[model samples]
Target: MIEATNTDLNSPKTESQSGLASLDPRSKILLACGFILTLSLLPPGEFLIYGLLLIVLYISASLSDCSPVYLVRRSVIALPFAFAAVTLLFTIPGESLLTLPILGIDISVEGAIRFASIVTRSWISVQAAILLIILTKVADLMWGLQGLHTPAILVSVAGFTYRYLDVLRSEASRLRTARQARSATLSAGRGGGTLLWRARVTGWMVGSLMIRSMERSERIYNAMLARGYTGEVKTLTRFELRSRDYWSMLVAALTAVIIILVAHFL
Candidate 1:
């Protein structure tokens, strides 16, 4: 079952107080985009600039009532993507830092620097996104995208995907519960199943889920049509930027420009 979003964009949630959560979603979106863009422009080996960026992020997080430890913990999602850059250690030509013990291959200094930079950038970017989500509700984020002149179709898709995530999760949970109920226990109190048998059952569950989801989608679509559904998502919540919103966005833009310039020139 899909849950409807009734939260207002202008109203702050109970947990989030009147700081970053009170700011206009449009300004927050623009600030996050500018910050990520500035981060991407920095060249490798700029550890000082990266440190400065982290400081800026920390300050922003504090203003938003977001814990630094929580931010760091959530940012670990970037580590797997960072590992994708591991090939750069052998691909780039530079002075050797050290030779691998098993392969006897040398790791280049330039490659190491680049890898570190990539990891740092990815970590910072993910935190920025997390901060945005923490500050704004999913409905408000979608509304902000519409305010920013983003494509309506894209916005609708993102909004629907987020809205139905709980539905899919509930369906999956029911399937898991049913499986557990039907499964037999072995002598050791573990579920009785060979590896291949478990895999086959998993495959069947996935296929069954796919078919059920399709049928549910059709029913939901018919219900929507009956209720006068439209192609574009319309919301009652509106955003009006105040003086503080303007000032905050201006300050963030200037700060991003200064940081990018400092990285490039000095």
Candidate 2:
């Protein structure tokens, strides 16, 4: 139900390309999928692979004109969950590397290593996904997902959500601005009742936004019906897989095999 803000949806679209524009959309999608799958399936206990993937992602982001600091900052929001999972590794019985008598806890070196590895791998994987979103438009990505066998219903929902998110976000922002202006005028000298008033205003704003969104949805459906839209959503085709896509797929397969083999024997 949450919609994307206009700035959130449009800022990435205006990003300066770093030569990736030459590659067809299919090739880019293949490369992105290949990298994500290969890295994710690799053993998370190994720091070397995770580190390598992080470096690869950083380089990729840099080449695509994505700010490394911004990507890392945004990616860290999910780090807490990763860290919580990592904490469990220390609790499970394993070879103890150190015992902290004051804390009454035994730390396993293997557990600590695995924890770091998983966090790093997760961060890198998220960065890859964020980069893909930044580089490709939502419509193009949805089409690519459809070609890759994502269910039609889910794809339709994703397309609709993307299209309406900006509209909803704009409405929310405008309401927020109006509330701030009213507060400034009504509470210029008073401070005690500001918080309560703001909370009430926010609740009302949310309710109004929902009602407006529902009305807009009805209008959109009616417009579609007037245009003779059937159950299917028609979209312009813009992608074709080239030799590069095959090459990327082969590299991904090889990487997966190699990682599995390494995890098994080494």
Candidate 3:
């Protein structure tokens, strides 16, 4: 029954940290989602619209007092999917720009535009998500989702995943440290000479780690039950929407709609 601390207590101040952190979590979530969904519908290759959106996003990041470099780096996590989207370069029909010799693949100009659009949209969407996370506390976010009538199971899963992810990581680190300590390369001749034997040992280590994880989970669950833990999560954050929340929501909705319209026009 561990709870999660989403924000860094020791992290230095950012520009938007104060402003974005003060807004209602529900408002932020809705606005971010709205922006992402609307932006997704935007026509590809509309650089003007994407530029406007990027400006808005960069401003939001700045207000949140978050580092622009950090946000850009974090958003790049979605870029790997660009490789998958690039396959459209071949499967899609368009004027051929060039062809590879060995694979005989024809690259199309239309496909190139579409691929750029895909990558741009993904980068923007990921940045939006990262901004939301940077400004919202994990517990407050879960509470907001519950208020929004999100599926209870999904909320519960998110809560537990956030809570236990660090625990699992710590356990894995300890296991790795112990293994390395016990199997020093100084005696590599006897126990770690053969590659096959080394692989078997690695497999055994993984099995042992899984067993430990299961035992730890069972123990934690039993302990929670003994303490009268139910399946319900209670939080102290209150969802009181003031004039600011409504105003922000209105501005965000209008901005999204306008952007969507502009995208369509472009």
- What lDDT would candidate 1 get against the real structure? 0.81
Best by TM-score: 1
The lDDT values for all models are: 0.81, 0.73, 0.79
Can you tell me which runs of candidate 3 are displaced by over 4 Å?
1-17, 101-104, 181-206, 225-228
Query: Alpha-carbon error at 233 in model 2, in Å?
Result: 3.3
Model 2 has a clash total of 0
Off by over 4 Å in 2: 1-7, 13-27, 59-70, 95-102, 181-203, 225-231
TM-score of each: 0.83, 0.76, 0.81
Q: What TM-score would candidate 3 get against the native?
A: 0.81
Ranking by lDDT: 1, 3, 2
lDDT of 2: 0.73
For residue 101, give model 1's deviation from the true position in Å: 2.5
For model 1, residues 1-266, the per-residue Cα lDDT tens digits are 12223222332333575667787788889888888988998888898988888888888888778787777877776777776899988888999999999999999999899888888888888888778878887788888998899988899989888777678767977887788789987878666789889889989999999999899889988988888997666788788999989988888888888888888898
lDDT by residue (67-153, candidate 2, tens digit) is: 767777667656668857757556767899888779878888777777776677667878777777778777878888888788999
RMSD (Å) of each candidate, 1 decimal: 5.1, 4.6, 5.1
Candidate 3: tens digits of C-alpha lDDT, residues 1-266:
01223333333333253656678889889888987997788988897788788888888777767766777866766876788998988887989989988999999989888988889888988988888887887788899898899999899879877887777766766766676667646544455447796788778878887898789878978987998879876668897887888988898888888878766774
Worst 10 residues of 3 by lDDT: 1-10
- Backbone collisions counted per model: 0, 0, 8
